[model samples]
Target: MSERIYSDYLNEYCKDSSIFLVKESEGRVKNFLNLDQEIPDQYRWRFSDLNSIVKQVRSENTRQGLNKIYWTDQSRNIEAYIIMTWWRGNELVRSCLNGLNRREVIVPAIAARSLLELSTVFLLNANTLEKNFKKIMFPPETIVISTDIENLVAKMIWGTRYQPKDELLTQTNIMTALKKLAKSPGTKDLMPTYDFLCDIAHPSFIGNTSYWSHIEVINPDGSERRLMSRLTDRQYNTEITDKTLWALAWSSTCIYNAFIIMRDAYSGLLKKI
Candidate 1:
């Protein structure tokens, strides 16, 4: 059968189940093939490595889900889907407990700890990627590490909130953390990535007049749904100085500590792994 005919047949077969899934899966495969065709010999190898990792992770997850999945193309074979059992449920439970008193001191502290764990993971990944990958387009820098942690903290805190205005205002905290990191002796060497980080931290036009601040997933079949909120005024300005970097780092560390405590309560889950 022709490629088009094969795709059409698959579409018809899976239409009742998940048309979107079929299309997205096929599209990813096609995009990867196109990249292999267009990229240089040297760069093609890197893309291949990345594509393999993507496929491996997806396959692992699929299998874990107990789904009888199949893939038509050999290069596009679907693998197991491994889902982490300990999800946001643990976080929500912790939040509920922490909401008992008006003081609400523990909840924020827990949030800070989670932020730190995430930052440390990113920092480790950055170092690993730097060492493993050759001819990297973006070199690893301490400034990048500081900026990334700041962004992560911003997302964790503001992204969880339901207010767009509040989310947009997170820039202040982000900037503060950056400045603190830059000033610290440990992070002083990352001064070079400082300017670049600042540029990305500034705000820009959101392009929509309507305050589409929140998102919802509604299942027509009366299934459970998930909702996510959106942040407005999304723009980055690149004028970060050493002072700004230091401040941002300090703010991030405070939040990171909070996140860690909350995560520690669920440390049993970590021990399982």
Candidate 2:
């Protein structure tokens, strides 16, 4: 198979000023990608706009050049194609992680702690500002997680996968860790961060992966292979109460400690290396 070149696709999709290419330093690219939320709109355009631009570019490309090109639309609602940059050396790190078959790799303990701390700072700032000055009051309505929140988590997980010897950390583990950290006497200020993780870790908020199975018999001995069909449901049931809050707090703590242990192990290996 031929190697997939990102630049080739860029050339095909990026025709006019609609797609702006920003050059970023290697470290900055990783940092931007690992942030807990999507880069603000000031950083990128909406995905809808990007798609419109791509469609226009493709039509123009087809008429000018008869080159057969295949491309995949990996953009999400929170992503903007206008702010894309080519990170030449980053693919090696991605390739290394891909070989390990891990998803949402664990961040270093220090990094994780720092992230929580930063989140706490943001929440505290917002809380303080809101308390000091009354903002426009909005009526209570259904609380929906913003696309920014989902994209932020996805980017953080995606970037962490490239960390050396990173372990896959599930949403459950992350919640457990945050809860533990929150309960610590010294971590009172980080309560908001703990709550945020708990929200993401709730089973109802997580994606489901159950499906139907199909069997294919290959031998007279009755050996068979099972094929599963993908299915999706839109139903959601959530119960948020004092009891649930207490449970989430406890689970967060467990996850925090688990992450600490993993970090220590990784550090030990790094020392030897």
Error of 1 at 223 (Å): 62
Write candidate 2's Cα lDDT for 4-65 as tens digits.
32233222322332312212112232343343134243554333345675665567443212
Q: How many backbone clashes are present in model 2?
A: 12
lDDT of each: 0.31, 0.31
Off by over 4 Å in 2: 1-107, 135-273
Question: Where does candidate 1 stray beyond 4 Å?
Answer: 1-103, 135-273
lDDT of candidate 2 vs native?
Answer: 0.31
lDDT of 2 at 243: 18
Q: Lowest lDDT 10-mer window, candidate 1?
A: 77-86
